[model samples]
Target: MSPTTPHQPVLLRLLHSAIALLVFGSLLTGFMVYDRYDKRFGTLNLPIVPNTQGIHGTIALTFLILLPIFAVYCFHIGDRRLVQSQSMQQLGQQLTEVGKPIWWVSLQRLTNTFMLIAATLAVVTGRMMQEIWLPTGELNHIWYIGHLISWIIMAIGIALHLLMSTKVGGLPLLLSIYHWRIRESDLPKNWLKGFKIKPNSSIALIIEFVVIGGIALAFLLPLFVTA
Candidate 1:
């Protein structure tokens, strides 16, 4: 494929699209829920929606469900696109003046990692939340606070992600993630054909396990805890 006609794995596109759409849906419905019930800061001039909380919760659950699989892909299959051990060193070198795509690529990798981490935070906190907590006038819960902050972080992260992508790979790279036509090399069967841990991939594996473990605990903890 040519530079402008960039190619991406079909799986990556599906995961990316699903996660992005679900996340934005969650954000919208979440805000509506907040606007309807917990308006500590301010309120929008929108009509109250009775099922906003339910809608938000559903979207969040869906996002959480797909998160682990996507995490695995990022940590292993797409590790090259994430922040590397020398990412800071690379970013540090070009902090003063912008010169090459190298620095921007490093920044983009770091942003991708951050987005994953931040999304995990959102998921865990959201799962920990009670559907009735906000509606019942209890807004100071730690999990709710974390989820709220995560929403803001995700909004900012999205902007940085876009800026970094545009800076590093330009329009072709930006469009690559959305490109539907997959190359023969991107076939799903080819992904796992002889797939094995790369040298020094232990760190990625560890991090992936940690995130997945946290997600599992988030869902399982509520079962053991009282309310």
Candidate 2:
């Protein structure tokens, strides 16, 4: 395939679009909910939505439902790209590697990892927070605090994701996902065949799973603390 030609896999494109919508929706509604209830860090005076908390909760549930599918696809098909190399001898070497496709790809993977982690944290913490609990005069719930932190992380993670995607793939890579012309051989039926594991993929898969587990652990911490 030519470098400029759009060549994203059909399934990956679909899943990416679906997950992006859910994640962005959750971010928007979650921010509204935060602004309405928890402006302890100051306020943006963002437009208030009716039943903002309920709307945010619904978006969160939708995100959680779709997250597993994306997570699995990422691990099974995209895990090799997601795992960082353990052979980096120094931070300087890694910094020198920037601007190349490999570096951008690695940056993309790392950003995706953190984005997933932050999203999970937000969902888990938001679920733990009582539905009736609003900031009102003052708020002191541990889950609420955790949710705030996750929201901040999610925002930063998403910002980095966009920047890195642009830096690495530019318009061609970004547009590839939105482009609709899948090659005849790259249809949905061929997706499973393409997912066959590589010879050295076990180590990469292990790293991917470890990262995912650590993110889940972040989500579970509040429950353990509050218990």
Candidate 3:
């Protein structure tokens, strides 16, 4: 009789799904919360969703709590593969054999790391502004500045990550996160095995542009109109 093989770890798949849902939901909810608190910014013009602040704030807080847990899980995965090694030689050796091309290097990883850092800062500042830290109005300016700056930095970091991923085969990487049927052979050996190479999807690109444009109009137009 043949021995049964163990099931592949579902943690990665779960993490990917959780992160996607949390981040996307958090962003949408954040928009609603901002609109409610600062109605001077004008409505988001989203289809039928009105006054989403309550929902958004609840989700954002939940996401904020979940992010660190996800981070720990991801680090565990990396550690199992020796991707988080302290030795430079081990790191270089691992990088050389990563699933993606050589062009996708430490800099790309660094960008991702920085993006997470910036996102954490944004969340922290946002919480402070929402009075999670202290009396809300007491430190409004400082918290607002921190939130805005961190948000801008995170946006830039996300943009760069997307561009670089596209430049060196990010389509498959993104798709793999969404599509569960992808075979193990079709993916990087591990989280740190690197991203997959594939052409960018036009549909995804268009959706991103539309969403960003809507967000910009919602947040920026009011400033000029009120001025």
- Minimal lDDT window, size 10, model 1: 192-201
Instruction: Report the candidate with higher lDDT, 2 versus 3.
Output: 2
Against the true structure, what is each candidate's TM-score?
0.90, 0.80, 0.56
Which candidate wins on lDDT? Answer: 1
**Ten-residue region with minimum lDDT total, candidate 2:** 83-92
Which regions of candidate 2 fall more than 4 Å away from where they truly are?
A: 1-3, 86-99, 135-138, 196-227
The local lDDT score (0 to 100) that residue 128 gets in candidate 2 is: 75
lDDT of 1 by residue, 1-227 (tens): 23775677777888889988998998899889878878887999579887878888888888888988888777767788887877777778844645566787888988998888788888877878888788689999988899899998998899999998888778898898888886787787776543446623555566666677877876787788654
Q: Best candidate, TM-score-wise?
A: 1
- Count of backbone clashes, every candidate in sequence: 0, 0, 0
lDDT of candidate model 3 versus the reference? 0.51
RMSD of each: 2.4, 3.7, 14.1
**Residue clash pairs of candidate 1:** none
Q: How many Å off is the CA of 49 in candidate 3? A: 5.3
Candidate 3: regions farther than 4 A off: 1-9, 35-51, 79-101, 131-140, 182-227
lDDT by residue (tens digit), candidate 2, 1-227: 23695578788888889888877888788778878877778889998779988887777777776776777677777565454554232212556675656666766777776776677777777767777678454467788888888888988987898887777777777788889886876776787754644423554566556545644654566567652
User: Roughly what TM-score does model 1 have, to 2 decimal places?
Assistant: 0.90
| lDDT of candidate model 1 versus the reference | 0.80
